[model samples]
Target: NSLAQFVFGFTESGRFGAARQTKNSLVINMSWGVGLGMVLDDKIFRGHNGFAGEFSHISLFANGRLCACGKQGCLETEASGWALTRMVKEKILEGSSSILVEKMNGKGEIQMEDVIKAANNDDVLAIELIAKIGDNIGRGIALLINIFNPELVILGGSLAQTGEYIRLPIKSAINKYSLSLVNNDTQLKLSQLGKRAGIIGACLLVRKRLLSLS
Candidate 1:
């Protein structure tokens, strides 16, 4: 309880606060890569080896893209911001037409922010690419919801700034794949923390460990 209070206290006091009104919550940070954290029964649930929340490496595709984990088809292969950039670059290489192509102007590289900016400007390719990434993300999240059954799922990291662009597909996937009993009660929310959630979480984690040692 003290650990939970401490973690939450720091998080709440920081720039981004809790996105849900429950004791049980799962926070999935999706940026260049994916990371996951959970609070259960009002306490942080770090698995026995202190690596329980490694949600990014969960296999989502068999024979899918190779992940940095030296595995094929991990969730990070298709759902991370890096994944989106990869997808966009692939499309551009294949001679796909889009405003992004003009923006890139032979740069031969695309940042996630570039894609997001194009999407916001209503670039067709950018929107489609983001939607595809969102779909992949939603599929992974559907599994997590079924497994964890948490009351809330908070999405953080740079990609979450796209807001409804990503959220809609995620919701659609959850609605289609997750059981109504679980999906109905699980509220999906964008992290109020934006990109600072990870830093705040790290500080809280250190505090929790020091407290536990004492």
Candidate 2:
């Protein structure tokens, strides 16, 4: 679902105020897990078995956190919605205070949306954690930029809705980690298609396929 949306990012000219552009672009959808999609020369780049963008499981950390994929230190462990919830729990356990604690009201579950709400409301701890996640995400993106040198990288998924709260950190990390030449060629922007991106992408993909067959 996420990949479909990311693929549609290549067709976002109408929504994001630009003309249809970029045969080479990438999209990163950061939800409970991370998803990636790429358009190379106006075609979707699917690797062997059509599973090219399992980016969440990329081992980018040494934090000893186990991923659901049975791997340790995957990128998702540090830069995803699941990671946000985990970080919130750890912060509370360490006696850090936030509006999130009050919002939970002892329910003992901190959804990513709750944290975003707190951060938007000026909750320091929430913002701090989000920045950390963005930094980590940017690090991973730096690697991608180095390899793909894509013209654009679109940030999607629920986390992207955090706006500048997440964008600044990711941009900072990309600048810090990627080579200046390659980094300069890439632009990062939030998905303007919003939540509708995935469903819309799916429909577009189907239309394309059907047209191709005809």
Worst 10 residues of 1 by lDDT: 6-15
**Winning model by lDDT:** 2
lDDT of 1: 0.76
What TM-score does each of the candidates earn?
Answer: 0.85, 0.90
Across 19-71, the per-residue lDDT of candidate 1 in tens digits comes to 43577777777678777777777666767865666678899887567899899
Off by over 4 Å in 1: 1-16, 103-105, 205-214
Q: Write down the TM-score for model 2.
A: 0.90
User: What TM-score number comes out for model 1?
Assistant: 0.85
